[model samples]
Target chain A: MHREDFPMLKKDIIYFDNGATTLKPQCVIDSVVEYMTNHTSNIHRGDYDAAVITNKLYDNVRNIVSSFVNCDSREVIYTSGATQSLNMVVFGYMKKHLKKGDEVLLNKAEHASNILPWIILSKQIGIVIKYVPLDNNYELTLENIKRCVTFKTKVISLAQITNVIGDVRDVYNIGKFCHENNILFNVDGAQSVPHMRVDFKNCYMDFLSFSGHKMCGPTGVGILVGRYELLEDMDPLCYGGGMNSYFEENGDYELKSIPTRFEAGTTPIAQVIGLGEAIKYLMKIGMDNIHEHEMKLKQYLLDKVKDIPNIIVYNTSSNSGIFAFNIDGVFAQDTSIYLNSYNIYVRAGNHCAKELKDEINIKNTVRVSMYFYNNYNDVDRLVDALRNSKDIFKIVL
Target chain B: MDNDLRREIIMDNYNDPMNKGLIDDNSYLKTRTSSESCIDDLSFMMKIENNIIEDIRFDGEACAISTSATSIMIRILIGKTVDEAKKILNNYKNMIEEKDYDKNLLGELAVYDSISKQPNRKNCALLPNRAINNMLEELNKKNN
Candidate 1:
């Protein structure tokens, strides 16, 4: 497919940093601009024709996301981003159920967004934070999780696919185990939801969170999917104008129904509407085809870089669209600088998971993440650049 | 003459860095600074004798720009008084910020003038100066 469909890719730039955020298609951008220019109105409040159209569009986006994830429309709660969605689950669920002396199980490979919030909550509530260690291949195993879980384990928060390494975990089995033990399961789907097929119903997950921007949608929008009954019992993260129904001088106040009850204050209406268009674009392309296209490019790059002496590739088993590696005897930032000279964009450093870096025994690595828009030609260009980098810069590698 | 000399200066210093290591514990004030965002670390040691900078040394893992910048900076600061060293550091910072820099005052440091063109690498080139300024701040705190 021609990249002209995405206006941002026309800048003579090779974009491989899709893990950070993907470039939005023209359709998604046009949807957002069209909404902002023409049908912009405050949803769920105003009574004019504009408000009616806005409400329908906003709620329709929710329905699109619900079908995308195979969940109920009422189960999806919109937030600022995945970070807020994660914090909502950690704080909202922990406040309702967990107490001092409870333990929340986590994996060593979790991003800071997934781990730090739970750590802060544990400190505040006096709950213990435990970790399930990754195997030698950087895969989280059921045996390791079973070993980590204790009788006091109240919650298990883990990434469905590690953001940096892109290793997929068996969240289905993990969720089943958590449910059997009466422990709440929270899956960080920020990386997985964009690249793979996620069925919340089949996975039996208690809570799953993902961001829109990573899926070729607009930023400032995310979805937290959970069971409707559970969401009804949990308190909203924020309380303000949109979430509450009736307020009085007394401390007691009545809150709105599910979804709206969880979403407080003003929403990212334009971005959400654009995200709905993004979903439609992805659906038209089909997730399975997108996944296959990225995997083929990833494998091609992996094969080409495998024989390059002194190059250490992280996560050889990752079928997802991310390649993390480092040139031996060269700082990752230096290598990234060399790549940037050729207009090839890649991410370097710890990738927001300092704990994962420690677990992997590397301070930082260069990451070349791919999207459906990327192809084998991009991979070959990266390889050619890598081969010529030392000779071009006259820097001994 | 200006552009060629600038590149030459930076390359020369990067190839052969001077005063690159730690000093004895009692010899001078020392501080360790690092860029966690980029994972760069440097340990800087300065030896002061009677209010004069007798010597300066740095040892750490960093990009070429930072390593070379430290090498050239120590060469300029050595044998200068404390106030003079501070002035030179300020001038070099201004040079990296694309200010009107004096070539005669910069000496070998003139080679780094082109670094201003690459704004992101400016932090790497200025790492040593940041440590020096931070060290001066600590010394001032002690004196006050």
Candidate 2:
């Protein structure tokens, strides 16, 4: 499995919290270290050899990102993280174009970043917010989307794969529907881009956002891929030295072109280069192979944990490598703490998708997310830890 | 459990928690507190008459350590005057933090003798006691 690539795995623990952030490989680390050690100069500013090399490596990440998502390099916008990317779209595009009485459609399964920005905008302007209905399993179906759409529906924003529930959403079909109906479509690709292959043109997405850290890249680097025509129409969220073409004393300034204008201050040069290396590493392994490995692990884990006596599984139909569940009488946090004592790490709480609390009818649950590095032995260790936890909880109660 | 402190007294209180319910009376002083890192949501209510804590109750969703700590705390607080309650609270905090304190004075709270070793659970064990300390301050202000 590519477990040896991550140095932190030497510590005795079964890491099942990959949905929060992934462990970076040695090649990605080396890329960042190489840049910092040798070519530690500003890009696009100096005429020296170091600066030229820096600029080339920095600009090359755009091509890497574009090819990773199957979009043109000019459409790839560098950002601090997915949060910043989503905010740019919210403040830069939606705030300007979406008017009062217009509607924005979302669902309960979306991450907080996707929903909160729209909520703030809806309150600021008198824009109405609506939700796509869900079935018994809290899944957003295509029929539900059609049923929820209104004449005033102007935008549809959702996650490619929800973090908590781990359901693989058919965003491509949804994007096609949005195009035919003349509505803007935005995809939160933070969870999906790291796990599976995503094609920008095939999905017909107007805008997509994702973080690099969740895909074995550095923490501060991410990408926002937008159609060139739409990106040209939107304004920049920040103004600074690098993004400007010319300036006058009377506050008059000519700004740079689309992607450059959107990236305001000093960019994350080392992290972006590291992300380019990460994208190459992922492509070399093949996204299909990674996806298949993850599914096998997921199936193995589910089959083993399903018959556990007091375990209550919340997401039975999830296609992704995330499992959300809890023991009958034990609190989610307590269970996670118990497992932690056995050198197993998992996430507990509402998992930042607090809006889904009422729908799921539980305030908290434990989440175990897996990645390509995780294998069946890790699953066995977790199952054994969970089984032993019951005996300990009896006395600790 | 590997640790005796987690096994014996903490577990005893968690399994059969005392003073856990809602007091609907208007005379009770009520407050709520929660921790962000874990599920430690709690609601506290105390009935104080004549500067004495006649009754105290807690109700919430929390982990074993937090729930058990609050349960053990309410048992030690009932029927004690505000001043005595404050003294016990300080002593119990000292005991859990492994500072020198009169072990006999802490009573059932001395069960947390080895809590200092588990640094992360210190907040879990002290949250409700801290809430009660706040309640005591509010009562003192009212009396003043």
Candidate 3:
């Protein structure tokens, strides 16, 4: 809706790889620049004016994130990205609670960041990692989760919106189920939080993780919001200077409280401040409006591409703005290259979810993901590019 | 035509790759490789008898650049000695990287000379060659 806010849009590029990361808005950029240029000092350690301002701005971001996700600021923890946030949960909580023979149910289509940590923990601790079976469309439903759950199921981890399939899962319902069954609900909001408004308190999520870069903020910053009791019980994934309240001479240490306890050493102060600005920017535009715009653009693109011949679409029915497809007899990377010749950008390959190779029975596919800045003209450009690329197969074969 | 994106020779070989099947014989030394950036997954199989390349085959899914480069590679490696095949693979890589190389030795792989300018497709052109080098290394270790 506010394309002008992103300076990258002014360039001659039609970026459709928003699922990988979104273009940063000018307000986010300006905020980061302002921090770097004027308020350039470490937080929580210095007594200088810049340092105090930095510390105040840095700590206040937690409240911004808390209000954004409808969670308590004390529960907000800063991480490197969603990857680190997920690692903290697996290593911090699940590693301790899940025992041998305890099962953790996950979706087959979850991103690698969501699946790999659990897999590593399962291997290390002898916990059983199981998948909630998908229906024929390679889609998961609450019914599938109900069918998969057992008495031994200790945790349920899934992406609120899967990166590849773009399925907007009924995570609220699933979270309620987890609460009733005493199972920990971990939501990988890497794909969903930026696109939709998340009510962390109402969703019954024990933990929620999302990255800043995916929502018009800078990279290397993410949020991990957990229930206060759960976070208090969870061990710190990292240990260092600022995270501890006191330390003994013989190597004993009393850690700080939640949020600060998890965020050890120096944090990405500028990026986190920029993330706060990004959240405000999104809120100003209204998240519902942004979501409605994406759905409209998705429907428009789908309507245009549906008539293209010799195409295999994996998830056209997805309400989210991800279109995964492959042209018949053409490799996904080749199609991506052909599109690149037209100044179009799209993601191709298994998309880093290697375990999904067996479930979907397809090696690779091209993904065209959209964001709020994208419109029908970009979709038209992609359609024209695809139509023109048909000649490459003809010339080659 | 985007000359950098698609060359006629690349397309021809990609559409009709040579030696594009795996060897069933257990005697063939095999190794697989994939590019981290692109979807270029390939396996190279070679049957070297007394240091001479008796047979060579490649079988895997890859991008057009990789498939075509691999097809051209099989043609040059089928009848050469092990050391000679290694030399040719090395020279082909040097050529792709825009290094000094004997043009006559590269054969049809010389078409990949422009790949040096296209940085992203460089891995696509190198996937099968790297697999070949890896397979040779494994074979040498076994014989030693």
* Deviation (Å) of A159 in candidate 1: 1.2
lDDT of 2 at A393: 65
lDDT (tens digit, per residue) of candidate 2 on B1-144:
246655677777887899888968888888887875566889999989888899989887888888888998898889898889888899888887888888777777766777777776778888888889878877778779
| CA displacement after TM-score superposition, residue A383 of candidate 2 (Å) | 1.6
**Model 3 DockQ, alpha carbons vs. true complex:** 0.58
Per-residue CA lDDT of model 1 for B35-141, tens digit only, reads 74566679998877888888788887777678878888888888888898888888888899988756666677766776767778888878989998888887778
Task: Point out the worst 10-residue segment of candidate 1 chain A by lDDT.
Answer: A388-397
Clashing pairs in 1: B6-B111
Model 1, residue A171: C-alpha shift (Å):
1.1
After aligning candidate 1 to the native by TM-score, how far in Å is the CA of B21 from where it should be? 7.3
Greater TM-score among 2 and 3 belongs to: 3
Tens-place lDDT per residue, model 3, A208-317, is: 99999999999999999999999878998788889999999999879888779888889999999999999999888877888888899988888887788988888877
For A264-321, candidate 1 gives per-residue lDDT tens digits of: 8889999899889988898888888888888898889888987677778988897788
Q: Identify the candidate with maximal DockQ.
A: 3
Give the runs in model 3 whose Cα sits over 4 Å from its true position.
A393-397, B1-8, B23-26
Please state the i-RMS of candidate 2: 2.4
How do the residues B84-103 of candidate 3 rate in per-residue lDDT, one tens digit apiece? 89889989888888889998
